[model samples]
Target: MERKCNNLPFLLLMQTSKVIHNQIKEEMAKNKLGITEFSV
Candidate 1:
């Protein structure tokens, strides 16, 4: 018997993460802030 892996959730999570990262990057750029500084 073989087990199948489900990739949809992981792919969706990565996609969502990338979108959020880009949005944060853009916002930080607009504010002239570093990621570490922004996080603090």
Candidate 2:
């Protein structure tokens, strides 16, 4: 139980970042931007 609890937040953070990453990719695609262009 202790190990599972410790990993819970890490898993949640990864999932949240995945969602945000997908959103950014979609936005970049809509704007016809490359990764480097989007980062600026």
lDDT (Cα, tens digit) per residue for candidate 1, span 1-40: 9966589898789889999999999999999999789999
Listed per candidate, the RMSD to the true structure in angstroms reads 4.9, 4.0
lDDT of every predicted structure (CA atoms):
0.92, 0.90
Candidate 2 residue-wise lDDT at 36: 95
For 1-40, candidate 2 gives per-residue lDDT tens digits of: 3544468888999999999999999999999999899879
Predicted structure with the largest lDDT when compared to the true one = 1
lDDT of 1: 0.92
| RMSD versus native structure for model 2 | 4.0
Worst 10 residues of 1 by lDDT: 3-12
TM-score of candidate 2 to 2 decimals = 0.77
